[model samples]
Target: MGESGAYRRLPVAERRRQLLVAALDLFSHRPPEQVSIDDIASAAGASRPLVYRYFPGGRQQIYEAALRSAAEQLTACFTEPPAGTPTQRLRNALDRYLAFVADHDAGFSALVRGGCVTETSRTTAIIDEVRRAAAEQVFVHLGVPAPGLMLRMAVRSWIAAVETVSLIWLDEGRQPPADQLRDWLIDHFVAVLTATAAGDPQSSEVLSGFLAAVEGQPRSVR
Candidate 1:
């Protein structure tokens, strides 16, 4: 039983996590600006005072915590085993990323779009950290020990595009299926990397490696 129906008090961490899970659930389906402490308390089956006990700053405090937790999850989306080719790893990563977007829905939208009532600099930093972490993971998959400016720009731009496309996918009701979107995104990454290679020798070298690895793989007929 949850704290709401419990006669005995939970340990401090359990209580806090229960409350945080409740907050994240509400945030997942709706904008954080629309979520409140009362909503979380109701969802968690706890009282307002108890939520306040755990998060004295109320909704703002809890929202940041939820965002941080979600950020970590999103950042981990780019991580994959190095066993596959770079594009294969990237496709796997995109599947995970898009799955997260589909799972989070409105929360993912709010997390990237920002401009929420309770959003703070800390929240913004958390989101940015996800972006940077994602880019770094892209570099890792490309086996680039030091990504040049052009390669960095290409990867970051692709990340931003992924975010944009994810929002569009949600708005369109997840049409085209996630696997289709994932394959298309992988193609886009290769294209962007190819374009970057035109100007940067480092990108050219990286692109050569990626293409060599992807040469024999089956790709979408486009």
Candidate 2:
């Protein structure tokens, strides 16, 4: 085959990934409702029939697939190795997450806020899975194999705060800089953990560890 011809025959996985990337790009810039298969095909340098061939369920299938792909990536943002203090580790994780929000502003907003016509039960579940996965990671970072009620609630609350603040940051045109947002979020997490610690022994232990880890690092981090 000629060099040009070689470029036309991607493996099945590569072709699907290419299409999903294109679709995600579109979804990130515009609402999912505004995106079309033709637009995805054009963006991917593939034909409409080709898109259908891979995704027989059509646009809805492609949208769901793209969302699943995005969810996987988002979930990974919180699963970093537990190498640093809880605050430092969370800062690193939040950096990745906020970067994702900034990169996929429109799509992130739509996914979190819902109300998209193409949304389905499966899509909603997938999005929820990301939140659960994130909260689990936070617990893992705290070294809590089995978190108590208050500790669990505190972690989940922080996760929800991160999502809410991310959406608001996007709406506000990403103001105050991403670092500032990340720091503020870390503070919020500390506050939530501290509040929970007062009433829960498990949370008190975790909070002590977190405080010791950040001790003498910097006032801002404290």
Candidate 3:
């Protein structure tokens, strides 16, 4: 079959997915503002008009979609089965999270840095939700049904550190290896919670629980 005929035979949903994957791949390499509709079309093996047909709002619309997809994947990084100790679960989660950073270097950097040229209210909310969801996941790992003020602040502070370190890791050429970074971040969490536990009884209890659980697990990844 001819090239255009082959494209025409693709299901609508499948074509849109192809465009999204292509767009995300481009976005993963460069800042979103640097990518163009023509670039996306060529990457997806589709024409500019065909790209527009699926995304009438053009690059901005596709960017938002790609951002949404990235957000979903990023948020999922912290979720794991409740089968391991707190630190063990966190180790698994950080492995996945850092892997995403390694894969989507530019995209992760752009999202963390903020003020993307295509920034819109919707995109901002999506990005914010990623942070919120990540924090919630940490709380879940702590087995906290309702976190107190100090506990919330402590977790959020560590969450912010994770983003900063990830950006720095990219800026520094991903030095120290991902497992090292992941272990360091988990250690920082333990330390932060420990400090918070000094003043906050809730953090005290959760940290105690986490420490007791950590005793039975492998110290770190092999």
Reference-based lDDT, residue 180, model 3: 92
Model 3 residue pairs with clashes:
none
Q: lDDT tens string, model 2, 7-119?
A: 46788899889899999999988888999999998898778888888899988999999999999888888878767667778889999999989999998998889999888
TM-score of each: 0.93, 0.93, 0.94
Candidate 3 per-residue C-alpha lDDT over 48-103 given as tens digits, one digit per residue, 9 for 90 to 100: 98999899999999999999998998898888987767787899999999999999
The whole-model lDDT of each prediction reads 0.85, 0.86, 0.89
Error of 1 at 216 (Å): 3.9
Error of 2 at 121 (Å): 0.9
Q: Of models 2 and 3, which has the larger TM-score?
A: 3
Better candidate number, 1 or 3, judged by TM-score: 3
Task: Judging by lDDT, tell me the better candidate of 1 and 2.
Answer: 2
Measured over all alpha carbons after superposition, the RMSD of each candidate to the real structure, in angstroms, is: 3.8, 3.7, 3.4
Q: Residue 102 in model 2: shift from native, Å?
A: 0.3
Candidate 1 residue lDDT tens string, 7-120 = 236888988888888898899999987998889988988888888888999888999998888888888887798776777788888888888899899998887787878677
- List residue ranges in candidate 1 displaced over 4 A: 1-8, 217-222
Residue 105 of model 2, lDDT score:
93
Q: Which whole-number lDDT from 0 to 100 does residue 184 have in model 2? A: 92
